[model samples]
Target: MIGLVLAAGAGRRLRPYTDTLPKALVPVDGDTTVLDLTLGNFAEVGLTEVAIVVGYRKEAVYARKEALEAKYGLKITLVDNDKAEEWNNAYSLWCARDVLKRGVILANGDTVHPVSVEKTLLAARGKGQKIILALDTVKNLADEEMKVITQDGKGVQRITKLMDPATATGEYIGVTLIEPEAAEELADALKTTFERDPDLYYEDGYQELVNRGFTVDVEPIGEVTWVEIDNHEDLAKGREIACQY
Candidate 1:
């Protein structure tokens, strides 16, 4: 499987940093960027081939592509998302549909997490599940978190930010393992998701999968230090936790 990163979003809240670079390019640990950590984690997990979906100041990534490849010792491919500034990540993810056929360990570009999370997902592979999400059961869920609901034995029943936090089982930590067998259906679902509402998140696409009878399982990454950088506050927290990793 290859490493897939969805880095196409325009983080308007992160003004100065995101003005010239995409959110993933924002440095968290000295000179090491979020994308750098992601690539390093993928390489550590034996996924030497990586694909990144780029937009919203994608030139920054292009400028560093060769350096990133050499530093990570991995082959990198870029997938373009033209609507990155106008639409949400459901379309950004769908833009990488061709790469998904190879199966992928997908990491959200703006998240900072340790290699153990990748290791955990890899360890849980081949368990008869097509789509596996990394859930943080320890974190206290809020309305801002992308929450999950699971049935007793049926895996994930719903994933949405709009859901009541009190009813959630855990929070999806912006990491997922998508098996090759699930690519076509997932791509189709993502297409439907974005076509229906350009503002919907890729998590909505996962909801679409569940609505179509797909079993989206979850692997709890027990008490991990991680952050999804959205605004300045998140970036500050990301920098603090990134060094620990």
Candidate 2:
């Protein structure tokens, strides 16, 4: 199985730093970047090959590719997403559809969390869960969170950003385990999503899976701190949470 990372977004909210580099390259723990942490986690879980979708200052990733490969001891393949700046991540992820058909551990490049999240998903693979999302079932729901409504807290019923916070069971932590079986179907769904709207998020792909008959399950990382770097405040939270990792 290869590791897949979506690091194409420009992250305009984080100007200056994002002016020259993607958010994944932003340093959170001293000089360690979100890309570093993600690759390190993949290494911990024994993922030796990784595919990264890059855009919006793709040169920075190309410049560091050799160093990143040497440090992580993994073969790196950079996938280009020309629409990364023009569209949202549904297209960014669709750009990696060819890679996703293989089993993969996918992590958003701008999220910071511990390696334990990787361990959790790897362990849960035994349950025959084809598509498993790392969820924070204990965190307080917010409007900005990618919320989920599950059936019996086991099967995902719906996942969306527009859901009312009061009805959400938890937040998807931007990490996922996609088995080879689910990846093909997921790629199709992502295509349908992007064709429907260019601004849709990949979370919308999860909704597409649910709309069909596929079951998308969850692995709750209870009380394990994580932060999605969206803005300056999230970056602060990411820095604080990253230190604990």
Candidate 3:
């Protein structure tokens, strides 16, 4: 199966650090950045092909991918989302539309993770379910993080951005294993949502799916080590997590 890494975000939160580089290339643990860690983990999970959506500092992302290929012989496909500046992550995700079918493990390039997380998510394949990693919020989450609201146990009733401080139980890590058919349906819903409202974010896609009566299987990871490097402080914490991984 193909692995898709959503790395095309402009990373406005990362600011000056991302002024010259993409957040995925930010240094973590000595040499391994989120980009490297993500690709390496996918390789360990038995994914032979990877498609990465790149935007900011796209050349640097390409160079890193080339270096990884030389060192580990990974086969990676790079797709550029030219609208990265104008669109959100859903745009980056759509860049890999052809590869996202039939349950590919989709990850955000800004998250640091242990290789086992990759294996575990990939194992969700063939379960005939739409699986999204349900991450326990270690601390207070911000407005941009996707929060999974559980309903009826074992089901995700809604996945939304922090609408209010009272709305979230935990965060939704970008790591997800979705069946191809489910993804296609979600993509169509996302397209409709976007056509109606151009400013819709990625979480809106999940909300739309949930509203349409789709069951989202939650794969809970009780702090197995993952970090979303949304800011400089987050980057520091992500570095520590990278070392442990």
Candidate 4:
């Protein structure tokens, strides 16, 4: 399976740093970027081919693509999402539908996490589940987290940020294993999700999959240090824990 990264968002909340570079390129450990860590993790798990969806200062990615490839010892594919600055990530992910057909271990470019999270999802493969999300059962949920709810033996019942945090089973950590069998349906679901609302998140597409009776399972990444960087505070937190990883 090839590694897929959603690195298309503008991350407007992050100002001057995002002015010239994408959020994924923001340095967390000296010169190492979030994307650097992601590529490193993918390489650690033996996924040497990667596709990155890029937009909003995509030139920066283009400029560093060769260097990153050489550094990670991997082949890189760039998936362009022209609407990344205007729309949310559902469309950004949909832009990589063709790459998804190869089966993918998807990581959000803005998240900083260790290879253990990737290993957790990879270990859960071959369990008859088409989609397996990295769920953090240990983190305390809040309104901003993409919360999940699963039924006993029924896989995921719901995943949304609007849900009551008190009822959620865990938070999806933005890493997912999408088997080849689920790719086409997920692409369709993502299409429907974006067409319905241009601002919907890709997590909503996962919800669409569950709404259509698809079995979406979760693998708990027990007590891992991870951060999804959205703003300055999150970036600070990411920098603090990134060195540990």
lDDT of each: 0.94, 0.92, 0.75, 0.94
Poorly placed runs, candidate 1 (over 4 Å): none
Model 1's TM-score against the true structure = 0.99
Q: Of the pair 1 and 3, which is ahead by lDDT?
A: 1
TM-score of each: 0.99, 0.97, 0.89, 0.99
Per-residue lDDT over 1-245 for candidate 1, one digit per residue giving the tens place of the 0 to 100 score: 99999998888899898888999999999998899999999999888899999999999998999999999999999999999999999999999999999999999999999999999998998779999999999998788999999987699999999899999999999999999999999999999999999999999999999999999999999989999999999999999999987
Q: In candidate 2, what are the lDDT values of residues 99-147, reduced to their tens digit?
A: 9888899999999989999999998887778999999999998899999
* Model 3: CA > 4 A from native: 137-144, 164-167
- Least accurate stretch of 10 residues (summed lDDT) in model 4? 7-16
Clashes of 3: 2
For candidate 2, the C-alpha RMSD (Å) to the true structure equals: 1.1
lDDT (tens digit, per residue) of candidate 4 on 1-245: 99999998888898889999899999999999999999999999999899999998999999999999999999999999999889999999999999989999999999999999999998999869999999999999999999999887888999999989999999999999999899899999999999999999999999999999899999999989899999999999999999997
Q: Is candidate 3 or candidate 4 better by TM-score?
A: 4
